[model samples]
Every structure is written in structure tokens, then in C-alpha cells.
Target: MARQGRHGATRRQPKGVAFDRWLDRVVTVAVLTAMVIGLTAVAAHWLL
Candidate 1:
């Protein structure tokens, strides 16, 4: 049997879980890329 939450029943679906994992990876990569870009910009500014 699936677990019940406060509002309703909750079940872990395989497709939903896989999608969540993929989305997490994409978001993590985007954040890392943004951070690297910002750091490079700062370094360039300091050097120039």
C-alpha cells in the first residue's frame, strides 16, 4: 500500500522520480555554469 500524506495519498512513480532527477541535474549544471562565468568576469575586470 502507498503512504498517505496529510492531504492525500502519496505514491512514488518511476517516471516522476526519473524526471525529478533529470531536472535536478540540469538546474545544478546551470548554477555551476553561471558561477564560473561570474568568476571569470571578475577576474578579467581585475586584470584589465
Candidate 2:
């Protein structure tokens, strides 16, 4: 069961104080893309 109390269901704030919606999505996408590229490079290096 979900916990319920007087201070329950409170919205959690983002840790990034300066980030906004657009920047958040952009950063996520960029990070994911970079990770994919890095992993592909490692795999290619191992294969060749």
C-alpha cells in the first residue's frame, strides 16, 4: 500500500536549480547520444 500521512504526496523538486524544461530535455538527449556513441566506439575497438 502507498504510504499516506499529513506530509504525504508532496512534489519533489529538481536538484538542478538553474535548469528549465527545454534545457532539461536537451541535456538528457545530449547525454544519451554521447553515451551511445561512446559505447559504439568501444565495441568497434574491441571487434577490430
Task: Tell me the TM-score of each prediction against the true structure.
Answer: 0.69, 0.60
lDDT per residue as tens, model 1, 1-48: 998866647765676888899999999999999999999999999999
Deviation (Å) of 48 in candidate 1: 0.7
lDDT of 1 at 2: 96
Top model number, TM-score: 1
Per-residue accuracy of model 2 over 1-48 as CA lDDT, tens digit each = 997857758877787746787799899999999999999999999999
**Alpha-carbon lDDT of model 2:** 0.89
Candidate 2 clash pair list:
none
Root-mean-square deviation per candidate: 5.8, 7.1
Name the candidate that leads on lDDT: 1
Q: After superposition, how far is residue 21 of candidate 1 from its true place, in Å?
A: 0.2
Error of 2 at 5 (Å): 23
